[model samples]
Target chain A: MTTAQPLIQARGLVKRFSGFTAVNAIDVAVRAGEAFGFLGPNGAGKSSTMRMIGCVSPPSGGELRILGMDPVRDGPAIRARLGVCPQLDTLDPELTVRENLITYARYFGIPRRVARLRAAELLDFVQLSERADSKVEPLSGGMKRRLTIARALVNEPEIVLLDEPTTGLDPQARHLVWERLFQLKQQGVTLVLTTHYMDEAEQLCDRLVVMDGGRIVAEGSPRVLIEQHSTREVVELRFAGESQEPFVSKLEQLGERVEVLPDRILLYVPDGDAAVVEVTALGLHPLNVLVRRSGLEDVFLHLTGRTLID
Target chain B: MTQLAARRARPGPARVPALAVLQYHLVGYRRTWRGGALSSFLLPTLTVLGFGVGVGAYIDQGVDGVSYLEWIVGGLLASTALQVAIAESTWPVYSSLQWTKIYFAQHAAPLRVADIVAGQLAFVLLRVLTSAAVFLLVTGVLGALRSPWAVLALPVAALLGLAVAAPTFAYAATASSDSWLALLFRFAVIPMTLFAGVFFPVESLPVGLRWLAYATPLWHAVDLSRAATLGTAPVWSVTGHLLYLAAWAAGGWLLAHRALRRRLVV
Candidate 1:
């Protein structure tokens, strides 16, 4: 089998729920051995697209293939070669932490003896071996999340799908999960993940697509998309108790573009430090001023004009 | 088959999708089987003792030409099977669908919806058959079972379990709350078990209600079990009762498949 074929290919993929369309016609192909991401806000159809690729939900209208097989006809066969970590933790509370892994493995028809050995190794990999016998109900959220990730790998799937892997994790836990995912990428595991956190996307994804309102707004490597959509640097000026709308025109000359927010004005500039000096020379005094490099958050905002949460 | 089962790794068709998922339930059951032990065995023992001895002494001649103990043993076993099956299906199915989302996890694996449903119902049948077997043993020691054919109740109980539980699984898959399950037990389970010739003959009920008992899956099981234990002829032929139970199980399975697909597959 040649590796040139895309592991997953979709053309004009669409998903509609009753009268409302959740995912519009969009084309995407995930290559083998690459870390791909779906970056979007809450209702941007990222999860819907992920579901279709995962072979759990059928596309309403499109040509889709996974492992070169029709998902609807060969779902079980395709799923046997996939590892999926859903958005929510679906760990079995009644079973112990280790039993959760072993039991889930049995679903893939992994023999009991082999399942036990793999479960042991996976528990250790997730750093939950010490809590092997502990019931799942008592574990912390991070522990449960790690166990869920470990559970997905029991079959040694060709492609792993993770849906918002660290949405509600603490910063430390988030870093731990990201580190584990990066190691998987290093090991040549094909990964397709969805996240609203730009840092998560930047840390894990080799290339990603930004989705907004059921459509792909931009697609490229994180660096490429950032360069394409947002300025290299940004200047923020916060004024006290004002809409910052009145100062929009006053700072227009300091940067290529000026965007106003509820409490601050942003000057999209090539160089933030240079823009700050020009702002001061222009006689624009604000309560607080800060300068920073533009990132994926800026790219998302520039393309959609709405914050990730909203 | 025995060698294949003994071996730890038997791939291919040996790993039937239903069997794979059933194996999961068995593993989980090992940790919590104690929680159900008391009710599974003790309740059957006590019910047989109390009703067979305590209530039977008051009546000089038992109904249907047999002692009350022999007469009720079949009904008791059938109803226990019904209760075991329904009890297993309700809360567990609801929790897996809505709370733990176990079905979604399983559906993500290589198992199909039919396999998951069949595997769960198989677990229910296991509980039903084992509990009914224990009751049969207790009644046999007590000399309440008169014929060797009484062992046939074991299979009858299993059939009853699937017939009722498959439909209950469909209901539980989409039920929003345990209160709905509670309402099912209160309005359906209690009334059906009570009136389906478990406590008394359905012939004594009014004309309209007699048909209700005949229509219930539990009554079919009770009739078959009661016939075997009393060494008497059943209300219908042996094939007739089995066919009816088979129909319920098949129909329930179709509904369950539809509900599971709707709920699990987005």
Candidate 2:
């Protein structure tokens, strides 16, 4: 690595809400010009961690330094250089789409003329120029999310923090947002994001940490985490049954590991086709069988338990 | 990096942080000011015409040796300021804090909680001042201005605005829902307007109620405002009235600061 200092540094960071510990001690470091991610299920304290990093929530313990300044005291200065897009849309309902950008820019002390030009530029960037004069309440969800993202870029912030950027969008809208975020990454803006979608992590994060129960269970590049936690390939078997538990013991020795779900059985092995052959030799006639490469989803299942997290 | 270079080269002016947040309120008002304008001008005009001039002709000897029309004008000015301040404070402040959550968005920016509160409170004061100015003119046109000191009522009205608006800001920030806000107006604001020397002198009330009125911010504002228009001495010393109003503002600001931080910083 180069001698450049990390943009954000945290050691044993903790956040508590009343008597409950939402975020337990966690360590993290985000370097400049690289995309970092927090991958977790809901209630994993990823948003709490992002809130502390955003300087809106004070840490209950440990140390946090964003841009080499204490977030507790130097919040305004740190926030001046940071842009945040929260999970929910918080756009101003009174103003038009374009006015939202201009007014938000002024919060950074941007001059009105500069603010106006930057707003127009950002509107074009987000492809919301045609709806510049429209009220915020009437925009579609995807449009509003894009506008919020544009608002986050009003100051051309050094770092952009996105908390589940595309959690509730359709596939087309998700791709559009993902594509825009990818372009920002290519432009060398440091991006810190949190998501439950393994595909999102794989698509955008150069490096990431998996959080479970307010703790970082694993941290590495996406490929590295997948490689360390899962096999090269997976064999998925779906039999004609409501539950796949009955076939678990029968297929246990055919692969490195066998996992049974509500509808399917997953076999972790070096070669998925060889595992399927072994399954056939075991006198198991499956209704459906498919071979696929292991992904971050499998890695998360291996790290966390099998019980579903909503 | 190029964007950073361009920003440095531009070398923008030193920005006052509160003014930046206030710009949002101002921009929003540009679209909604028409609705507010109608109420500020029309409320006092109708009250003066129907209640002041139209009804004063029936009071046998008038009030305190002056025409009843001129007698109630100053109190009405104070009342108008209180109404304007509270109107701007309750629903809009609660909306920004909870419903729209625009204040949370502002909190995410490079602004302190003080800046957000001060900026919006300043806008409320502006509303109070402009509405008071219009009220002064409407009453003046209807033969209510008896002395040159009548203009002082504008500043007195703004002070009263801060006295009421700041505390209401705290309530809005901390309230769980608009139902609490409805109860506040029904219990607090309505009672103050009726009992605090706005429609009649507090001295005419029972001793217990009179003392209660004396403790209200509106009573101090009304007394000072009456002295301003009638060229008469206020019931309390000028410094005492000013101090009482200023103390409420300071205390309310502290409460609002705490309330806003609690709501937004979490």
Candidate 3:
């Protein structure tokens, strides 16, 4: 949490593919022993940024420093301290689970004995020790992701980069992964992850940036971002057999903002209970109503005018 | 935690990272090497028995002062190594890049694109040399090694293997579909093996076709191998063959590095 020195720093970083610009000039910095996240939907250049930080892709322009070293000249040296879990599972399918970690550790020149011990410990950390001898191909999606996470920890890296660590997992699977990552964070391993799941960001990221169209639109803690961009509460109203768009004019001034979605109209207000009372006073008899605290999803929708997952 | 402290207190010394990349493939190969054992030993033995002894019995006057069994034995040895090298370079390299994504995993680690390409070439060399070793053993069992100098063919086969594999590795990395690899085998690898003096002397072909075989890497390999096994190599010009093969290996490595960098490094 010390700002005197950051573990990763980028200034005006850019990435372009052929004629298409994937990441525009943007700046970011992350401190040691903290969890930072890039929150964006697909095609927002989240994975591209992760690749640059991982030292697998050279930045097309601008300056990026990881561990206070240039990426191009010192990629190998930098990567030695990085553990990257790519969006897709790139585990060696032919090798068994334990072999995958042992082999990966060998790439870092870790001695065989140490690699074996670390692989065992990491397997236990990820709770995959019982399946250590199983082939990676037949494992469930959750198991594969856990294995990938465990593989990333083989080097005991200073910073672990996870690109959409829980993209395709079931709810239960994601929670298990989140728990393991939380443990890593508790152990003082800095984690940088990209996820479109707002709940995930809220649960795991101590601080994050919301990216849209390859640009960072906002940066803050999940709670701070939500409070900055949205109200303290949200009131959802759904009128049966109504277009819902017509109610926008009626509900516009009821709160700070009104958002009309396909099935519901959301009112951003300081107090959801007061907003509901005000709505009834206006004689808007709604078929359904729900009041909930605002979250990162509201912040994202407010900034981008699009859902994060969409 | 202790290991983490150890790595932090003293990072490992810098070494050629390609060897680590090579170790990855070799470790995977350990599980699959048994599957290849049957083919590596069986195919060459069959080729020697089917053509060297079965067909050579018909040619009363051996093709070159030696028995046809001995003449074809050396050529088959070189072609076998070339085939093994090209085979290793094609689908396995392609799958590692595309399907299996082993190179992506490696690239995400500390290794560079050049290290990945070099490691793949090294693995191909291991395969070619392994097959060559077994080929040499079979030759010895069949009494094909006429001179003690025949041991030199093993290293010669290694050079030939690199010459063929390096460029194929570049092609595999850049290819969009696996279909093109099938064409490489059918048009390039098969023709070089069958027509590059492995089955018969290139001098017997039509003049236009003779030059084509002379230009092939397999032909140079066969010439060197035949000379080593027969002890009839021209002493003054052997360096020329070695240099030519070296040129192929060096050039192919450069192209593979470029292609792999483009694909993996973005």
Candidate 4:
């Protein structure tokens, strides 16, 4: 509830497993009622960081505080006030969809009658009320994910930790999940999530950290990151050729920077139309051309030297 | 309850919130209880009919001054508790830890690793008590129960469950594969149940094998339960049997807590 102090604060946080360090010393802070994110590719230690924040995995080094309380000493107290939706569903297969929520609520010591009401409300909120009695085994991946998200809210937690909220869902399912998450944000629930999808981070995060190889590489609002790291517009040139390598040198002087991919050449420029005009004046003909505004994907690519998805 | 309140006041690793975990398991048990109920009732009935009536026809002289039905019935009740306890501790514990990952789910909440382990062990004891109570009732109807002290077998059965479950929970938590459980049942559990003086006197075995049986938790449970049912416990070293069973229960719980912490808290 306090704005001056962050709900979660970590300084030089580290997580080491046996001989390998999954998360190197990193600093992070998440204030109340804001949606924060950790965005990165696989093996980037995003999940490990999320696990540490959820208080399930102990930090091998550094200091962590949740609700201004030490993680090691006040884990249960802190966890009681936090909701965690793990990367996997972890739903009980034997219990019905409703029972999953109710049972999880009971773990937090919610009274039976109150738990029943909350389960019903969450079922409706997740749009799973129709299938409330059905076993979780029959639900689709999207439905299960939504139920997981719903389950996370059962405690009416001060902060919700979502690890890869929508990794495997189809576009429509992902949109529905995003919409519900947006609703939670509108209701002023603090959310910290991890995801590899640039669009998901762009869509949901108020501020995010870009992680790679157990360290924070960059941190900012998506717009600020894009503005700072990438150009305003981009022109993608795909030629009917065996390789895009030769065209990269020819297109270099036309834009601020040129990146060559297997199938296309991207020109980062202040203006897409000017870049396209320059490309045309160079006497190089492209099979197809696309001019678009820059996004977080471009920022990630610009900062990390790799495509966000690949 | 006071311990829980005290933990809530100043929570740490030394004290885990247990009631919440117990409530979670109770909710999970709601749907699965029916299947467990059938086995709890049917296994005892069949064992009594098959081993008590069919096998008892051959032995005119009861083994311990009682009918063969009465002698074996008490042992069967104790073994029933052991079976229920081990069954709950093995596949269900493994499935919760590995397959369903329910333990991880609880770990994400206010519950600690110790709470999850203790709550599950308590649930196993609840199940063992239920099955043993039903088996005791059947034994009574069959005229196998001889003394008023037979009522004490219910709690004794729960103690047996604790003895078996603590160690089995630890093993299941640490096992890497479900196949290991099959091997455990075949080599360890089945052998213990068969030769733990359940069907015949352990004295009939060779001296070395008899001492080996004496070391098992199930043998102690059977010995104590049979004595209680037949009013023969006062004649033996009852304190020693109770102490031995208590040792297994206490030691098993500590080992199980460590194993669960290794698996879930990490």
- Top DockQ prediction, candidate number: 3
For candidate 4, lDDT tens digit of each residue in B1-266?
Answer: 75344323322222335776666678778877898888777888899889988898899997877888888878899988888888889998999989989899888988877788888987888888889888888778878888879998888898888988999999999999999888888987889999989999998999999989998988888888888788775324878878888999999989999998888766
What ranges in model 4 sit over 4 Å off?
A306-310, B1-17, B234-236
Docking class of 1: medium
- Output the worst ten-in-a-row residue range by lDDT, candidate 3 chain B: B5-14
**Each predicted model: what fraction of the native A–B Cα contacts (within 8 Å) does it retain?**
0.56, 0.61, 0.59, 0.59
Q: What residue pairs are clashing in model 1?
A: none
Q: Local distance difference test, per candidate?
A: 0.88, 0.90, 0.89, 0.86
TM-score (C-alpha) between model 1 and the true structure: 0.96
Kindly list the per-residue Cα lDDT of model 2 for residues B46-81, writing each as its tens digit.
998887878888996988988888888999999999
- Is model 2 an incorrect, acceptable, medium or high docking prediction? medium
Chain B TM per candidate, please?
Answer: 0.93, 0.94, 0.95, 0.91
The order by descending DockQ is 3, 2, 1, 4
Evaluate residue A53 in candidate 4 and report its C-alpha lDDT on the 0 to 100 scale.
Answer: 85
Tens-digit lDDT track of model 3 for B1-266: 87766545433412777887788888889888897999888998899899988999998999878899888888899999898999999999899889978889888888878888888889899999989999999789878778878888999999999998999999999999999999999999889988999888988899999889888888888999988888887322788888889999999989888888888987
Model 2 TM-score on chain A: 0.97
Candidate 4 local lDDT, A1-310, one digit each (tens):
4589999999999999998988999999999889999998899899988888888788999999989988788888888888899999899987899888877877776765677878888989989999999999989999999999998988888899999999999999999999999999999999999999999999999999999889898999999999888999999999987999988888888888887778888899999998888888999899999999998888877777844434
1 or 4, which is superior by TM-score? 1
Off by over 4 Å in 2: A1-3, A306-310, B1-14
Write out the backbone clash pairs for model 2.
none
Q: Mind giving the per-residue lDDT tens digits that candidate 2 earns over A1-310? A: 4538899999999999998998899999999999999999999999999999999999999999998999999998889888899999889977999999988988888877777888898889888999999999988889999999999988888899999999999889999899889999999999999999999999999999999989898999999998999999999999986778889998888888887778898999999998888888889999999999999999999888643433
Better of 1 and 4 by lDDT: 1
